[model samples]
Target: MVKGALLAMGVLGAGMLPAFGPCLAAGLPDTPLDRARVLLVVQELEITLLTHPSATLALEAWCATHHMADRPVVVARKMTLPPADPVPGRVRADLGASATQPIRHRQVQLVCGTHVLSVADNWYVPDRLTAQMNAALDGTDAAFGHVVAPLHFSRDRLEFARLWSPWPGGGQGAGGMITPPAAIVRQRAVLRDTHGRPFSEVVETYTDQTLAFMPAVDADYAH
Candidate 1:
């Protein structure tokens, strides 16, 4: 789970104070707020890519090529009992049983300029959302299974007035431009197994290019 403080930064509400430039670094001096802006742009692009249909199929094909196929199992048993002792010294044998392995699943989320895009799909099931994301991104096979699960994309929306408010004794000019603060965007995607256990989750915040993955989140797999 992402630190609660970071998560709190993405919440939306009235009377919420604007984040200062210093707060953007979260104590990392070298990581400037400007750098965060670039990361946000990349997140926006990622969201656009994920919404493309062709990209989705390309990702699926990539998974097929890279991942091994699930093996099948067969079972056989034999029992023998000599004449009839009370229960007879019975002999039994079993063969050809494979392990009940877990299935592979994936999820992706994108956050851009106060808008969030979420796509949740599984390798074993058809994914319409993935298809839409791929088409939007113009993605091809290059991004397939290699991208892995729990991918997150994020972007930031600027509030110019907030950036300038502290200047000149913190006074507002008669003609100063000011607008309502834009809400940060958030997207979440969860992938579940047949038993309704979530195998993967992708969560992203738009304002700071933050991505989080919680492998244990609950999911509904009924359908």
Candidate 2:
């Protein structure tokens, strides 16, 4: 669990962003103030992810700054056998790869201590990476963003979906406590090299634990 004050990251009283996603209904908080904290933290994190070229580096900063853990975020392999997702024609097009070109698929939990910040799926063209990079990815727990850092990649946002929010429509007449659900947001983006050639496509789902740093809605609001 996250431990520390949110003073370093700050908070918001108003300006709730409307959450949009099919799963929003499943992730709503109880009260208006509870919802406010969720929206505030989610908004800040969304912006944090965009400020850096490498998501791994960006998340490491977030983890440390928020005191989510004693150590920085690390990629934890979520399965014993790698997931076998069927590659689609459109996926190949999105990745700028010809049909039959080799693609590496990895599923991982981006964890800070015991808290999982994001669950990610990466489909990358291994041919574009250095041999050492491929070896590290195949053998170690190095994050996809860090492993390919030498490419000087840029993430091109393709989709930003909010899975939950406490806004104009959700958690309105609430009597429940502020308990955040699992995931708050999801994103799909393509990673491109220095020359702007697409090499990887990823989907990242950020969890409610990102809000774990914030104090309880009732406690903070009471003061």
Candidate 3:
């Protein structure tokens, strides 16, 4: 009965802290620290997703944890790869190839209901993947990691950065500058096949949409 009630409320899974349920049911992250706290949550979530077997399911689990499992959507917008750009030096080194390598690019926006959780730029080698896998990527909304799961892949995160542009913090001296709506969490990673050859390079940016339901920080709260 209790479990059914929780499920009805859109809170599923074992990790949904009952104590934090109210916290999850609140407004967007407004203050700088509130955004930072939510970033911490999302960073941990991303770390788990990177290593998970099925990244699509991992994303769904994350959405459930944040009370967004009812309607999940990953709108994968295919993009034409230029001869240059987003092909960072690390990606080349990880792939053991130069920028000349044939790679397909796509941008994805993972939305839960009306909120956009993340936007990812994906660059993958079609040569390394099966024809069916490539077809699934072109035709489905499944994540690249899921489409390539047959490779039994592993991931190496190259970078993680916090973007605090319009809002830096209180004592940080804004100099009367206007603050932006929210912050961003950026990550760069390479996905490797079982034999440890990198087949994909992904850069995911978690936008302010992720902050849509984060809790507000208390003014007197000390970090």
The model with the greatest lDDT is 2
TM-scores for every candidate against the unseen true structure: 0.22, 0.78, 0.64
- Which lDDT tens digits does candidate 2 get at residues 177-219? 4544566777778999999999888777777666666654335
Q: How close is candidate 3 to the true structure, as a TM-score?
A: 0.64
Candidate order (lDDT) = 2, 3, 1
What is the Cα-based lDDT of residue 52 in candidate 1? 30
lDDT per residue, candidate 1, 18-40, as tens digits?
23112121222122332343334
lDDT of candidate 3 over 105-199, digit per residue (tens): 66665556666555566768888899999999988877776678789887787766665432344222243322233334566678889998888
Question: What are the RMSDs of all candidates, in order?
Answer: 22.1, 9.6, 12.6
Global lDDT of model 3: 0.56
**Model 1 segments beyond 4 Å from truth?**
1-183, 192-198, 208-223
* Over 4 Å off, model 2: 1-29, 78-84, 169-175, 216-223
Candidate numbers sorted by TM-score from highest down:
2, 3, 1
Model 3, clash count?
0
- How does residue 185 of candidate 1 score in lDDT? 40
Count clashing residue pairs per candidate. 15, 0, 0
